[model samples]
Target: MAIWQHGGMPSSKNTQFAVAVHVLTYLAGQVERGPVSSDELSASTNVNPVHVRRVLGPLREAGLVCSRPGVHGGWELATPAEEITLARVWRLLQGADPVLGLHGPNPDCPVGRGVQRSLAAIDGAVAEAVAAELERSTVQDILAREVQGACSVPGQA
Candidate 1:
């Protein structure tokens, strides 16, 4: 459930971030396979192909991905994975979602007003921090780490 749906501050806009990273990382690993269909990306994400396409829209516009139409067509990175920064992807995908949401409590309530003010101050900072961390790594970094981890695990295949 969404954090706001539970009467609390919303969690990070991680769904899109996670899906974008997963899709891109999967793509990075599959470069030799040529353009990958939304269905193929959705398989690893456990999401519908429609949802994958929806996410792909912005990524395509961002010049992070390119899509081909007709048979033997799908999506692929516009640049190498190492050149795609998570921070750039995060900015493109975040849109208007807040890092923290403050439910407008009773307008006349002094405590509610104070809390709102307090929370608002840190929202941008929190988002900045998240972006900074994301900037520290690229999709290629994630793929390398996962591959190395997978290889280290015995009998995991």
Candidate 2:
């Protein structure tokens, strides 16, 4: 389950950030294989096709990916895989949402108000740390790791 789904003050969005990364990494690997339909992407990510399409919208707008139409229609990377950093994807998808979901506690309760303020103060730092760590790697980095046997696929040994 995703953090957003937990009841700390749930977000309206689902796991778009993870889906975007998966879609981009998959596209990078399949670049020479031609466009991949949303069905294919969804199958690989084990996510709904509608959700995959929704995730693609922002990436398409940001020029990270492009799509085709008709019989062979689907998505491909618009930019080089190395140019698409995880930080970039995170910013495009998860930037606006807090690193930790925040709760709207009762204003009249002193303890609630104090806790909310304390948590809010640290949120920015936490978000920055996440982005910084993400910036150290790109989509190509992940692909290369997989190719070099440095990482394992979920279902394969």
Per model, how many backbone clashes are there?
0, 0
Per-residue lDDT over 1-157 for candidate 2, one digit per residue giving the tens place of the 0 to 100 score: 3334433554556688888888898889888878888988887888999989988999999999999989989999999999999999988887467878788776668998899899887888898899999999999998887654323234431
| Candidate 1 stretches greater than 4 Å from native | 1-14, 148-157
lDDT digits (tens) for residues 36-63 of candidate 1: 8887787778788899999889999988
Candidate 2 to truth, TM: 0.78
Model 2 spans with C-alpha error above 4 angstroms: 1-8, 148-157
lDDT (Cα, 0-100) at 154 in candidate 2: 49
Looking at candidate 2, the ten consecutive residues that score lowest on lDDT are 148-157
